[model samples]
Target: MSLKYLKIMEEIKLGLATGSLIAGGKLPSVRRLSQHFSCSKNTVIKAYSELEKEHLIYSVPKSGYYVVAEFQHRTNENEVIDFLSAGPDKNVMPYLEFQHCINQAIEHYKEELFTYSDQQGSYSLRVQLVKHLQNLQVFTQAERLVVVSGSQQALHLLVSMPFPNGKNNILIEQPTYFGFIESLTLHQATAFGIELSMKGIDLDRLEYIFRNNDIKFFYIIPRFHNPLGHCYTNFEKKKIVELAEKYDVYIVEDDFLGDLDPDAKSDPLFSFNPSGRVIYIKSFSKIFLPGLRIAAVVLPSLMNSNFLRYKFSSDFNSSALSQGALEIYLKSGMFTSHLKKIKEVYHTKMQTLVEACDSLLPAHTHFSKPTSGFYLSISLPEHVTAKQIVHMLNEQHIYVDDASRFFLPEYKRDTLLRLSISQVNTNTIKRGIEQLAQCITLIDDRNDDRKNHPIPNNLFLL
Candidate 1:
């Protein structure tokens, strides 16, 4: 399908954003827009019609279209600078395009959607996934891929299931994805932690842990790690996989944000050991539609049956409708186009965030400098806690995450803060950092004051 109309829609949206097109302002006539864009009148009409459907604009009986008056109110900002939300940017989400896909899917698979589906997910969707995985350097066939509700479900299942290695414990990075930590807690599984920083983990420590710990599998987010946004180098990934093989330990590679990696030369851990020492999990939640709850996991063929049994107990199958719609979206090449657009958008946003941090943060503060990812972490000064910063920022309607929950109990620290670039307005990033720097300085000063002037022990008695 031609995306010329989408371009037209984007131009109008940009106008609205920049105040060039005010609420209730009359829009250019169909003929004028067609002449300006050098497109057909029907194309202009279609663009306007779509905007009208979205309630961004309306048409009179005989007059030109006008922006919806209430649109101004919706777009008006109350000065909320959000760094907590980790979802895709609301402005760029292809909701309308996917809505079309949903309609097409219902018409194509109306009979199959409501009934029970294959416990391993739809075969047709898996085929499309096979093709999609190739883009991420994960070479696998549909036979080895299992579609799940999401990557979280896959991680939860792996945490509880018995691995082929027969080892009982799980090993993870010290500060990892919180959802996975929650799974470990609920299952009461024995887990070991390896410290990770922007520089990556210590290979010697990892080898020692792998050899000593009765580790079943190492759960790793190889790209754009949650909270830390730390991505491993190709050499590190290859070594990790080799060590896992040498130790008879399995590797669960969660490449959730791999699609957004700017390094085309970088390969997933699965690519290093395609014969199945590594299990690859890809999540669509970060870069694509999250509400669909769709993810694909490439498992070792030997473990597929056992994994399916566990999946069967969780839910009969993932949403068949979601699978069907995603298949069409992939087959139609919409997903590829969407990826191209978002890749640049996120890369630019991440750069902006890092630049702001470098210029605005205090000298005592340290932060990760990821090339392109949704998160950038800040290490606060000693005696300055993430809770203090989070609470202070909340008063100003600025939001950020406390990274304490991301750590295992034994490795917990209170001075780490995570700032997500996904949902924050790109224009407001510098301002948010400015406020955050002030908060950190205030708390650091208070700590200094307390040390210099201690209250006397007898003051309370008096």
Candidate 2:
């Protein structure tokens, strides 16, 4: 009776008012909403029950709850086009299946799952992870693996920790993952940037930086890079690893979306020098449940103890229950099954998005052609800034990410836009791109007109 339930109801109403939740859209799970509201599951359920009573929402058997309203006479303008969300598709998430695994974990482990566990991680889950990574060509032993809350945690700790080389600066790809950029900023670490694009980076420049700069580690997203959707070739991966070894710079390979790679022969940078030179971090957030907050990092055997010390100081251990459930899911072969389904789903979705971009985008605009990944980046016309397009499209409920935050100050570009295909409806991809193309053309034309008919400088004084 805290009346928090009423607040939940009101939030849902607000979502409805703003047209974000949308008619026939599913609401967040009870567990997810509870975490959001910092309340009990019972409180969320009570709120949902009240919403259902008021004909505002309804729950499906085995499935989660959803809004009760339906889009009546829905038109293209009224429909919300979502290309901004980066989470996994809700239409195919193994929610019910994972819930069963969670229950199984609770039943099997009982109260043990609730208590503090090993600082390194649940050993059993590591065993499963060892088997799981083989598919991605990342060969490693569980003994070298330390599970962290997420890849972000691993990157943050690695940024602050001392490397064997005793170097003070870090090397990162220009327009890299925003989280990692934020981590570097917070730690105030001196970072050098190597420009990456659809054509890949300049190897000679990379070698020059490694040789000249006091570099510790080169953080790389070898496959399906965030905000760019650029995947390096195997040749590039091996050469980069060799360069790292030559310059004594360790490589922190964040292969977060490696599982979605369509090319079976493709390998992570870690595969080139798995012994100790390359530290591989694998995250299940994109491929599985983001809420689980589980990611495994394969470290050098010599660094395992130190990493654990850092891990302990950070949070002592990752969620034991999450580890247990993931272990069960992987060991039962359910994870493999889920991967197979999502592989096809994401591949098809990416293809759809790429096709739409190729067909609709303006000639001056260019986009990354990723084989398979959650993200695709568009380089807007030089005359049109990402801010103008983002602001205009947001009014129509079409969402996109401005990629300026992904870059350091010197490398910042106001022309890049990131579109995530993971949560977007495939059927709407064309329309979204069409709207985007129109926006870009409008801005480009306007800019051209201003240049053609310059406002006199004295007009400002008038």
Candidate 3:
């Protein structure tokens, strides 16, 4: 056997000694063990067979392997918890109902589901989406709607389809969504970053980029913008629309998290620009259930023909069954009820995070109070990089998004971190924040000590 296989067997032996792999307990399949050891099935089988011969384990026909005898002691516990990413809390998901919906959709729409759907999405779903948009005060006719896999795909399609040539550039807010930057880069399109303030994107920098570049489109997440969690002011929204019109630049408005806004009074960019210049995208994933993976884009009537063609070439269509189930969910008013439940839960969670930040974070560390959204971005001391903080926190099993990932390579802003409040409850938020605070304090103290006492090269020479 190879040294590597021997090493894996040794580890397995240690696991057995420590009672980590309990007796009478089923071991992972040969394929799984092979993957874990980065070895072949034969190698794993050899090891298992050796163990079995030694009377350590027994294999049953068809059922595979199991431990032969019980061990006396307990094993070490796994002590890792991820906090940096945001998704629906596993505890909160309505799994039973969601599963029922999925099964029903599959059984009922089996024949039709086998084929490709309409590129612009199912007609029935589009109709429901139109109504949903209308509810959000984003009025668009059914013909203008294009269903996409998710908001990410919607953004990708928009980034790819709207421009006539690859040479055309798009404008984005500095420290924007990392995924957005990735999508823009994939298209080989130049991205101009406008500096952001607490209010929103800096208008002067925005104007400069517009005047200097042959920008084809400007993408903005006006409400509860990713990372920053800053909502564009009503005046700023108007200015953005006016600027887009003046510069003759198309605006890709991502209203992905707008549904969770506590105050639904604020209007979207689409509300201002009913014309084709503003393309509005919305996602039901965050608010409802992510497994649905359903999102819609409001296309201008002028671009409908071309957009439809482009969409067809991409995915043929969104899932018909998902669309059907979503239609039922939307019409049943369960979606709205779910939204209310989510808002209530998220609102409390956001408040808890805010309070934690106030109590736990250093006086020097500063963050904005977000009116709405799942996240809050804090600006740290320039000397303290978000990457360093993330690394430190991750060692303690507390994960956080480093702000640098969101910016363009040329645009380096390291002293920022985004804290997502969506996936965790208020109770857990306290402990997570406390751990995060400890990490920050240690980093800051290390930096202070470094400043006080610099290492001398002469010591190395001596």
Candidate 4:
């Protein structure tokens, strides 16, 4: 609609909000309103019709339109106990620190903030990232780094951009980040999933796929992998870099949660060869505020120009104000201190989940404990399905992600639950876990196979 029609709606809304229009109060007739506003009568009719549909007003055939009663069409929802989200908790955000950084950024670069920034990103932020990457075992200068809106954007660019390899096949881990796996199909790209072992993906299988197919790249979350929460060992990282070099393929390493815990044992895939083959992407929104909208991708020297060109065309550049604030925040030395503080909180929450799972979950259930990050993978009995468990859990007001989604449809029957205590408070972990255990027991009790998997009801409480 035109601005004039929009203005009419805004005036009516204002009248309602300011108490000038009471419930059931009559509104001006279409003919009278049109004359008063100097518009067509049809325009007034259209406005009234739209407002009627919105439940803000109602029309009587002869009396004309009248305002409706206060609109409320929602029920009070029950509080949810979440074990699914991997995003940072909002209640404990360092709002003051960020506000200070934003204020400082506006004051220091008042003029620059309004102008268009470099296509790649703010150079000052990229330079600061060089020092930051050093601590993460990656050493790259600003020229090799391109700031992206987030890891999702980097993943899209990598997936869609032309690869020198003859084939468009990409390799990923089975039961990987389902969100990424789902979107890969959008490009009509062929993808192969390598089964993840205790340490990492099977080296023998990875090499076999590389030798057989003209693979473009191997997308991986080597650090704090989602669903599995498994970090590749330094030995595995070296072998991965070596295999990529041998097969002439690229490795897109998503170190989104690397900063959450600086476990020295698991070096990044890029650390093996900074300039060789690894494409490293770091997500700042994970550790910092979610709206930071700043993630840097350190491209292989040969691929730097290609990625920069693609990013330039896609978004022109990421939010410079966010980049500027982050740069100031880092320079203030608060980023490190904030990391230290949240590391402790996340560690404590993780421990609580582990202890609860150990005591409450069934004897046949198996899981892996993560050193850092907010994920744990639980393998349930073959008799149960992740979807069934998720449905039952939801009924109890507990939320978790079904690991079935992380795998391809053919492998979806695999019964696993990817639980993360990232959103739930620490004190609620035991209760939620205990409730889940009861639901599992109830399922067993309803089945004829209850005798085979006998778990005392009191055992979980003990």
293-369, model 2: which lDDT tens digit per residue?
99999998888888888889999899999999999999999899889988998999899999989989988788999
Q: Give the TM-score of candidate 1.
A: 0.92
Check candidate 2 and list the clashing pairs. none
lDDT measured at residue 353 in model 2 versus the true structure, 0 to 100:
95
Q: Estimate, for each residue in 1-462, the C-alpha lDDT of model 1 and write its tens digit.
A: 367998999999777644578778999999999999989999999999998887889999899999987544232345678899999976678877888899999999998987999989899999999999998888989999999999999999999999889899999997999999999999999999999997899999999999999999999998888889899999999999999999999999999999999999999999999998999999999999899999999999999999999999999899999999999999999999999989988999899999999999999799998888798999899999999999999998899999999999899999999999888877778889999999999999998999999989999999
What tens-digit string does per-residue lDDT give for candidate 3 at 194-305?
8775666778778777767988888888887788888887788888888887777888898888888887678888888887778999987777777777889887787777
Candidate 3: pairs in clash: 84-399
Q: What lDDT would candidate 4 get against the real structure?
A: 0.80
**TM-score of every candidate relative to the true structure:** 0.92, 0.86, 0.79, 0.78
Report, for every candidate in turn, its global Cα lDDT versus the true structure.
0.91, 0.89, 0.77, 0.80
Comparing 3 with 4 on TM-score, the higher-scoring candidate is 3
- Winner by lDDT: 1
True-structure RMSD for candidate 4:
13.2
